[model samples]
Target: MSDTLTIALAQINPVVGDVAGNIRLIRDARARAAAAGADLVVFGELCVCGYPPEDLVLKGAFLESCEAAVHDLAEETAEGPAMLVGAPWRVAGKLHNAALLLDHGRVAATRLKHNLPNYGVFDEARVFVAGPAPGPVAFRGIRLGVMVCEDMWYPDVAETLGESGAEILVVLNGSPFEMDKPNLRLEHARARIAETGLPLVYVNQVGGQDELVFDGSSFVLDGQGRPAAGVAPWTDAVEITRWSREPDGWCCEGALAAPVSRLENVYRALVTGLRDYVVKNGFPGVVLGLSGGIDSALCAAIAVDALGPDKVWCVMMPSPYTSADSLEDAALVAGMLGTRLDTISIEPAMAVFGSMLAPVFAGREADITEENLQSRARGLTLMGISNKFGPMVLSTGNKSEMSCGYATLYGDMCGGYAVLKDVYKTTVFALSSWRNHTRPPGCLGPGGAVMPERVIAKPPSAELKPNQTDQDSLPPYDVLDAILDCLIEGEMSVPETCAHGFDEDMVRRVWRMLDRAEYKRRQAPPGVKVSSRAFGRERRYPITNAFTRLI
Candidate 1:
């Protein structure tokens, strides 16, 4: 038997439902692998139909198309490295997520995923039926155990493979981004290696699918279950990882991927999510209201970085409460980014709205209703741009606002996508600072200090009323964000939060606001999810529930 195998990890991005495009990617990767003298090329799970196809696989025609694509990829292996391609398979009226090995112009074997994850952001069990745990596939006299994304998370599947005389393990993943998840992947992979005593090759998908962004941090683990090498995260790369069968076992000689900072990981996640959403959804560009505040400033910078400055359109819709500093700052930021900035006064529209509503509220005091009207007027203007032009409106609300019901329903919430929907206010400030300090590679916007220093140092306000700041309605951002993290992500009860040295009244008040804001979050547009507990899919609570801290 040959004592060596050169394997290539095709950590490429795939657009969902683009069967032909995905097949092209597989073929291209195979060519590259063949040129590199690799014995096999591996791709992430469901590469043919893309990961988490979500009801698209339910259509018989879609499955048939994916099957045809698999055969085409199989035919592409006429004179090159064998390919481990993942696709949808239908057997006897049942559907499965399978890994197909193609060599010599035919499929050598197929391994069905034994375990399907049904937890947060994954509903694979609902779409794909689990197959029986089985042995490994033979590749050039090598017994290789193939595992999908979720299969390797447990001990059962790897144990089955090790017991069945499997020599090596290969894991294909479409794992999404969350803080500390990459570290967790390495930890989980090492555990599987420890159980099997087999060197492992991990391949993950890259690019964004709706709210999910898969950071392709493909890597290799030696027989001792130690980190060998890794591919860069949040980008596309195809590299041949050379592995040799040693006296002890197989060892990987691959280049180590550079570690990305936590802040860069999050920033890249946001950029990729926005890019893919705009590109995949056929939106030509994006437009947002640049209120000269930190939230809008950070969002504007993200948009320019994601879609380039030319594709970004910034609108300054100032009203009666608009200040000279805001106008100057918005213009300064836009000029720095080189994106087009348009000023549209909302005064005329607000006057009309106020007059129209005054007759209905002849005896009522002007309060939040009037404030919300200003917000709604701005929302109307931004939505109008989205309708007239092709650019999708980008909402700039952060998680802290979403948590406490500080945002208006039809007002500032009007947009096609929310860039900072899951980002906390404190993180937003930090991210702004990071961007100003360093420009991420691949960003088309100008590099230095895009966000003004004054914007970062200013007291944040919605500018809906005179002398009004966010602190007037909500607590200080540092305090509010800390409490929100405890309540939303930590899932602490009011009493539990108060026990952590937080003021009891503040904890109770924050809990009530978070609980009451469920309906608003439900209506929010999808945003990039970089946290463990995002609003839309990860955390779901009943909007009509009467449960509260008062109970």
Candidate 2:
């Protein structure tokens, strides 16, 4: 029997449906692990075809490709350290999220995922059937309990594995990032360790997948529920851990990363999400309307941080309502970021639109329609630039503006991706201020301030009209964000929300606006999801509902 073992946790980013590319990633990680003298290398869940492949796993061809890739990878184990990787495996004509153990150049054993998550950005139940409770997989004279992502959440699987004589519990995860998710993951892992009385190893994938951003905060916990080792969050890493068979149980020793602040995590999530979306989808770069407003300024900074200044193209599409302070702020932001900024006057287009629509409306007063025209004109200018160039337009509206319908549809909302779609206005201000003082690790932007101090301190405005500010239409951001958190994330009713020391009428008003803006959000571009209750797949509300009225 082996007295000691070395295991390498592979925290990698894989693109969904890219089987061959994923194989290369696995091979690369295995090679690094072999160099580190590891006995076995473990990767995250569904690393063969990427996690949450959604409906891509349903296709017979895709499953066959994944299986072929797994077998091919299994052959590589003939000469190097064995590998434990996750893939979509089909057994007895039923598909399962399986973890395959590759040893001696062949597929040695497979453990299917017992618990399929069906809530909150996860819908595995609809794709694959859950497998029976899994036992330990024997490797190098030791029994290792292997669990898929959701399997570790509950106790039944860990209990079964422990009772079946598993020595170490290993979990393969594709858990996405939320502000509170890291703590929750550690809590669950510690709980499992407490129940099984066995050391645990967690390996999670890092990268952006659609609206989801997986923070690879992979970690290890000893039998006593103490942290033995950890991989840093928001980046790919291959960490090797040494495990020894102690008298009581197995103990692990490795490096532990420092804790990341909540604001840093949120900012990193945005940067990772934007970087992956643009790179994976084959966009050359990003172009955003750099208004003097906080939302747009923050978006510009995030874009530069994600794709360097050379890749980010900013345009100042000024209109008659644009103020001198706004013009100066936009120019200063662009200069500090070292990005290419161009000024395009939308006045000509607005005048042309007004002349074109004058015959249809002879005596109609200039209301929001005219204001919307300015936004549309700006949107058109940006889109035209995108079409001529290969850069994608980035929408800069935050969750608060989107929730209250304070944003114009297809105007400022026109973009292939929204960087701040899930972020609140208060969070936006906080992130901008934080970025000015500190630059998170792995960021491509400069270490100094990304924008002028006045940009953050100034009042946020769309500048659609003279002396216009965001508060002209919406409540104070602090109040609005708190009420939004209660209604959306907390799922509290009007009475419950108002009980949080808010006016009942204002709470009801906010509810109505949130409900009414569903269609707009539905049409909005996908952005990073840092909150527990993001707008897209996580939180879905009916466009034509009377729930708000009844409330």
Candidate 3:
């Protein structure tokens, strides 16, 4: 009998629905762990078909492919260490989120996930059928209990495992990032360990799959409810941790690096998410218009940092009303970042479009409509370049503009991805300053002055019309972002927002704009989500609603 076990946590990035590729990853990870003398190697949830396969699980062919992949993985374990991996299993006409125990080139045992999370970016109920609470599976000599993603969020799952004579509990997960979520996971694991008195190992996937960024801070919690070992966020690493059975319980011998700061972690998540999306989706590079405003500058910086200077292209689509300072600062940023810079003056395109639409707008006084034309012309030019070349167009609009419908639809909103869609305007400024001063971990771009000083200090504007600024239409970004956090993220009622030192009228106005902008947001492209309440799946607001207050 063994009194100690060394387990490997495979913090890997899986491409969605790539069964063959995913199986290869699992095999490679198991081999690495075996070479390190680990007893078993565990991977994130849904390793076979990838996480949140969405509706792809409904297809019979896909399930068959998943089964075939599992068989291949089982076969690959012939020479390596044991494997505990997650996959979708269909039994008796019901689908289950299952964790399989593979040993000696065969399917040793199977455990089904009990919890099916259906809320907030998760639609497990639509794809998966929950299984009864699984008992412990004996691997080698140790009994291990397995839980899928949502199972760790609760206490009973771990307690049931502890009661069933399980020595270690391993959780496979694909949890996404949303501002301090790693800390929340740590707290939850601590609570679970306190309840069960069992060592817990959590392995999570890392990468961006359609607006969701999973920060792979896979960790192990000892019986004392403290973190024993882990990997960093926004990275892929395989770590083998040794745990010994002591008089008290399983004790960890060594842990990994310290946890990253919230800011740094979130920033890495955004960069990782964007980089993976652009590369994995087969885009050669990215192109975006730089307005010298914080949003565009920050997006450009993130693009360059994500994909190197070779992969990022910056175009200055200056219009008639574009300020000299804006033009100079935009050029400065492009030059500093070493991006392939080009100037596509939208004046010519704007004139052509204006003439084409002149008969239609014959009598209507030139309002925001004409200004939006210029924005759309710029959008078309960027898109044309994206089509002529192969780079995906990255939208530079932030959450604040998206929230208040301040962005022109089919104008600045045209893009394959929006990097700053989840970030607030105030936060955009903060990130810009942060990027200018500090280089992100693993960032390939140059460290200093990625964004120009003047770009960070300038007042935000669209430059669509003469003397037009964001403040002309909406509240100052600081005030507006606060109110939006209250209305959209905090879910505060207008009265509650007013209680927080905001004027009632202003609060009502901001709330009204947020309500009216649902249509625009619905049509907006998917972007990396860095906040708790992103406009996409996290918060669902009706496009047409008469009710104003939640109460």
Instruction: Name the best candidate (by lDDT).
Output: 2
Model 2, span 1-551: residue lDDT tens: 89899999999999998888888888999889999999999999999999889999889999999998888888888887999999999999999999999999999999999999999899999999899999899998999999998988999999999999999999999899999999999899989988989999999999999999999999999999899999999878899999999899898999998999999999999999999999999999999999977888899899999999999999999999999999999999999899999999999998899999999978999889999999989998899999999899999999999998888898989999999999999999999999999989988898999999999998888888888888888999999999999999999999999888999888988999999999999999999999999999999988889877775
Estimate every model's Cα lDDT from 0 to 1: 0.90, 0.93, 0.86
User: Candidate 1 — which residues are off by over 4 angstroms?
Assistant: none
Ranking of predictions according to TM-score: 2, 1, 3
lDDT of model 1 at residue 183? 91
Give me candidate 2's TM-score against the actual structure: 0.99
TM-score per candidate: 0.98, 0.99, 0.98
Candidate achieving the largest TM-score: 2
Better of 1 and 3 by TM-score: 1
The candidates, ranked best first by lDDT, are 2, 1, 3
Off by over 4 Å in 3: 549-551
lDDT-better candidate, 2 vs 3: 2
CA shift of 535, model 2, Å: 0.7
**Local accuracy of candidate 3 as per-residue lDDT tens digits, 380-470:** 9899999999999999998998999988899999999998899998888777777788897888789787877777787777887788777
Q: At residue 2, what lDDT does model 3 achieve?
A: 76
